[model samples]
Target chain A: MTDVLSGLEAGFAVALLPLNLALVMGGCFVGTLIGALPGIGPINGVAILLPIAYGLGLPPESALILLAGIYYGAEYGGRISSILLNVPGDAGAVMTTLDGNPMAKRGEAGRALSLSAVASFCGGTAAVILMTLFGPLLASFAVKFNPSNYVALMVFAFASLASLVGKNPIKTLLGAVIGLMLATIGIDANTGVARYDFGVPDLLAGIDFLVVVIGLFGMAELIHLVEQQVTGKFTILPIGKSFVSMADLMATKWTILRSSLIGFFIGVLPGTGASVASAVAYGTEKRLASDGDTFGTGNPKGLAAPEAANNAAAGGAMVPMLTLGIPGSGTTAILLGALLLFNVTPGPMMFQTRPEIAWGLIASMYIGNVALLVINLPLVGLFARMLTIPQRYLIPLIAVLAFIGVYSVVGNPFDLFMIIGLGIFGWVLRKLHFSLAPIILGFVLGGLFEDNLRRALSISGGDWSILVADANSLVLYTLALLVVAVPLVLSRRKRMALDTEA
Target chain B: MADRIFSGLLLLVSIGYGVMAFTVIKAPFQYDPLGPESWPRILSVVSALCCLGLLARPDTERLDLTGKTSTRLVVLLVLLAAYAALFEPLGFVIATLLFCAVLARILGATMGHAMIFGVATGILGFGVGAMILELNLPAGPLRALM
Candidate 1:
């Protein structure tokens, strides 16, 4: 307990620096604008600005605070479009549109907005508190993990992803394998031989993770948007008196608490994200509500449930990334990539070696949440106006940003071609209903996975059974098996149940 | 179906990749028993297995790209390719201007609006790269001015 407190104190000392504070505010403001605009999301926002962050040569902690601020700020801003325009800014905010739009139509846009901000504040704050208490404990436990245990843990993460990300595990597994294969390019670390360079000089240096991320999420998203011919006028509902009474806050306090816990737990699980958390929270609240029939209409609880859950889940997703070195969601995976770019390896040793990065990020979350609430509530009207930006401007701007961002990274024109190639590849995969998240996670974790597997085998003289010899390895393997198996069984049962109903 | 064709292609690629993995020359001073080729071999085998599974139970969903949409994508891709090819030779300002204008036009902006936006993006992007971030973007014809 004392250690956590002291760590937090040191963290605040780092995060409260004038430059870092300015970055946090700037990032939140930019993130909110990005999230408010239709078709631009947290992923694009982060990927576009990542190069700027790198070029600035800011300290690692300050950069992380900036990026993390963008993350949660996007979550808070996503609800604006959903409530006002009935257009979800991202996948996670899709549920918000169900009741949020209806509430706005009834001239309660301000009430819904205020309720969402308060609930998001509650969820984000609670999750950070939980993280402050649990992050160190988790890291301490993970510190004892050996190479074999790490291999099993990676397997668990992959299996969970395969079972959880998309409806089809086959596609997800294929994406993951492709990613792992991509990771094997360039020079081999153990033996000084190039594995998959194919004689190109640039290939000798291997693919940059940032290039792939910008291509896959940023450029690919723009291409996908273009394919849909996204040209139309958006109608934003006016914000009436922007204030929620104390009675309104008191009414949904229990719901906020319950959804925050639910979202945090779900977010902590690998492969699950705010979409799942918000969905489950909304369903759970609906079932528990006395006015269950009023769910899709305009209930305050309906609005609060998903808003609270998604914001909490954003905080929850960071726990796994910071402690276990495994990203819990797609956005967190990108954050992990950023950390790697900063030459900071996230894992058990991070707490002892880089406590400032971990705890400072935690401390910044608290301040960011309060900052978001304060900035968003009064400037809600200003932020909502961003949705009026036309797709003609937005789409071209995204493309240029992707180009500039990728070009600035390696200062090579070849990376530009690579971005275009990967952008098309990502678009094709999206069209086929294949999820891109697992592929990215797989790429990020692939090097670590291979290293651990090789190290464990080397220690055991290539004995495969050594993976199951230790108790921790044994438990991890068991859990991995269960993660892979239980999902298949449950999905089969669900299909059978639907068949019977039919 | 698209899924079957994709899976079949993947199976072939995995097999080919496995063959390539075997062809990797062994290092003279190898320390570990499992050499550099081991992991790739393992990955290719796993990929081959996954591809086989996909082939056996291919996803029923088919990609539905209309002619117009597909044409737009191809045009956009060609424009992007041209932009990249010309990026270094033509420089950041001119190349970005051309790329942004063409993209904006393709996305339904009027020619005048597209050119204006393109010029703005070019100048701003150049300022950001050269001035703010201190990056060394190619200057091409604008080299002397810069």
Candidate 2:
């Protein structure tokens, strides 16, 4: 307890720095704007700003604080479009639209916005508290893991992603495999042999993660927006009152608490993200609540459940990234890439080596969440108005930012074309109903996965049995198997039950 | 139809990768039991299997790649490619101006509005990138004038 308190105190010392505090507020503001813009999600927002953040030369902790602020802020801001425009700002906000848009239609837009903000605060704060207590304990356990154990852990990560990420496991798995293959397109550091470089000098350094992110999320998102312009129309609701009654708060108090708990735990699970968290929480509430039929009819509890869960999940996803060096969500993968850029390897050792960076980020999230609640409640009108911004203006800015982000970071004209190519590929993949997150996770984990696998084999002198010899690895492998098997079993039983009913 | 074609392409790529993994990837000396080739070989086999699964059970979905959409997309892509080609020689501000203006015009903005937005975004973006970020975005011919 003392250790946590002291560490938190130390973290506050860093997070409370004038510059860091400014960054948190600034990031939250920008994040909210991005989140309010439909078709631009947190991933695109972060990917676009990442290079600029790095170029600004902020300290690692400060940059993390800013980025973390953007992350949680986007979670908060995603509700804006869902409520007023009936369009989700991000995938995590999809559930919010069910009840939120109905509420807006009923002229409760203000009440819904304020209530969801409060719910977000409760969820985000609650998740941070849980993360503070659980993160260190998990790291302490993970620190004991050996090379073989880590290889098993990586397997567990991949298995969870393939089974949990998208509608089709095969598509998800293929996406991951493609990502891993892309990660191999450079010189092999260990053997000093190039594989698939095609004799290009620019290929020697491997494909930059920034290029991939901007290409897939930023540039591709612009292309998606262009399509949206053809298919969809924008009509935003007038925000009504901007205030919630005390009775409304009392009605949703328990829903917020329960969804926060649900969201936090799901977030801690590998491969799942806010989309899953919000869906599960909303579904659970709908099933458990007596007024379940009122769920899609603008029920305040329905709105609160997903709003709380997604914010809580955002905080929850940080635990694994901080402790085990594995990203719990797509956004965290970008964060992991950012840490690597700053030469800060996040793992169990991060606590001992750079407590400030780790704890400071946690501390800043608390403040950022609060800052978002305050900023969102008052300026939501401004943000909601942003929904009126035309595609012509918005699309151009995204294109320009993508170009600047790539050129500033990689400084190669070839990467400029590379992003455009990747953007097209990403658009085609999205059209095929293939989730892109698995590819990112696979890419980010590819090096670590191969490194640990080879090390384990080397230590065992080519005997693969060492992977199964240790209890930790055995446990991890079993967990991996269970993660894949349980879903298949449950679905099969569901089918059988339906057949019997038929 | 798109899924089938994409999967077939993926299969071909995987086969090519597997062949290269075996034939091209060689270590001067063995540093570990599992060499660089082993990982790629594993990935290629898995990828090939997954691609086969996708091909066998291709998603029965249709894409709306209408003539208009395709024309706009191709023009946008060409404009983007040209932006890259011109980024070094034309400089950030001018290149971004032309790109954004043409893009805006394509997306249904008036020519005047597109030009105005292009100038505002280009000059403003360059200002922030150069002055605030301290990044060395190429100034090109403008450098001699400055």
Which digits, one per residue and each the tens of the lDDT, describe model 2 over residues A361-438? 988987888888888888889998878898888988898888888888778999999999999999989889888888
Q: What is the TM-score of chain B alone in each candidate?
A: 0.94, 0.96
TM-score of each: 0.96, 0.98
Query: Candidate 2 — which residues are off by over 4 angstroms?
Result: A231-233
In Å, residue A1's CA in model 1 sits off its true spot by: 0.5
- Cα lDDT for residue A381, candidate 2: 92
Model 1 segments more than 4 A misplaced: A491-502
The per-residue C-alpha lDDT of model 2 at residue B29 equals 87
Which residue pairs does candidate 2 place in steric collision?
Answer: none
Give fnat for candidate 1: 0.70
Candidate 1, overall lDDT?
0.86
lDDT of 2 by residue, B1-109 (tens): 8889999999999999999998889898895999999999999999999999999999846776888888878888898899999999999989999999999998889
lDDT of 2 at A132: 88
- Kindly state the fnat score of candidate 2: 0.79
DockQ comparisons of all candidates to the true complex: 0.69, 0.78
Find the candidate with the highest lDDT and give its number.
2
Error of 2 at A98 (Å): 0.3
